[model samples]
Target: IVLDRSGSMAFAHDEVAKNGSPAAAPPGWKMGHAVPKDARWLDTVAAVNGFLDIMDDSSHDERVSLSTYSDKSKADVKLTSDYTEIRAAMNTHSRKFKGGATNIGSGILAGGKTLGDKELARSWASRVLIVMSDGIHNTGTEPVPAAQQVANEQIMIFTVTFSDEANIQEMEKVAVSGGGQHFHAKDSQQLAEAFRKIAKSLPTLITF
Candidate 1:
């Protein structure tokens, strides 16, 4: 999974903040409510955690990798069945989500590299890359070309445009280039449902 942790992800779903806008500190003593100030980011984390749970309950033999991008990209975990490791990396990265540019291409490339690593990957397993972004790509390599490069290597890319301002057109093209599907989620519930649907559809790919 390639998740966007860019600066703009710190805003509400309807509020499209600039690329470098300062992130509000996570809710604490200063805020009466326990929920974090960044509603969109909170929803994203919840949806991802929910995705993990659904995947765990499934019968498919799946290995998952995590890559998060801001101004840069980092592959937090290599492809593995150990979902706990992915969660740990995700939580650690969440704390550092202060603010940065969105580099969707970097995130996609990072995820593809991990899945493409023959040494770490199972030869018989299906390869899929899920790229979820909440803002426009403001930096790094062009995403569609990156998707093509990965798809050429047999890695299918699924994209999730997580807000009203997310680049739906560009993401749709990326999904097409990668030979997968594009899903748009305007709210948290839909976001979780999208992940659920993606997870459920994966095991059937080889049969088709």
Candidate 2:
């Protein structure tokens, strides 16, 4: 899976302050006032943890990987089946750094490389890339070409757009180019539901 860790995510409507203290909603903001006191980042972390908790482990031969994109992209882990380690890494670093531009193209390319590695390619029945972002492309190469490259390699790419600033048109293009699906989430609840749907549909390419 791929996550967008840009600065915008810091204000993802659900993220609370970096410190443990409650986040204050803007004055007169009735809607956001009802949001949880914690930072949206923490909420995202919890959502990811929840999704991981219920993931099907019956397929012993399956492998999964994670990558995040920001000013600089990094593959936290290569394709592996070590859910314990993956879960630990997610809990530890999911809310680490919060700055820079969104280098989505590089992230997708890197994810493709990790997925295309000889061992994973030969063993898994399917290879999938789930990209969650809340903003438009501001860094790295254009997202469409990178998405096309992934598609050419026969890797499925799923996208979740979580902010009004997100370029819906571009995201849609990328999804179509990659032969994947595009999803939009306006709030934390919607985002959580979108993730749930993606998790439940993990074993197949078709959306639920």
Q: In candidate 2, what are the lDDT values of residues 52-129, reduced to their tens digit? A: 665644444556787877877788778777667667665555434444578888888878888888865664357678
Inter-residue clash pairs, candidate 2: 14-40, 15-39, 15-40, 15-41, 16-38, 16-39, 16-40
Which candidate number would show the highest TM-score if scored against the true structure?
1
Q: How many residue pairs clash per model?
A: 0, 7
Q: Name the weakest run of 10 consecutive residues (lDDT summed) in model 2.
A: 28-37
Name the regions of candidate 2 deviating beyond 4 angstroms: 14-37, 57-60, 206-208
Once fitted onto the true fold, the runs of candidate 1 whose alpha carbons sit more than 4 angstroms away are 19-35, 206-208
> 205 in model 2: Cα distance from truth in Å?
2.8
Instruction: Give the Cα-based TM-score of candidate 1 against the true structure.
Output: 0.89
Model 2 residue 111 CA deviation (Å) reads 1.2
- Model 1 over residues 120-177: C-alpha lDDT tens digits? 8987777899999998998998899999999888888899999898999999999999
Clashing pairs in 1: none
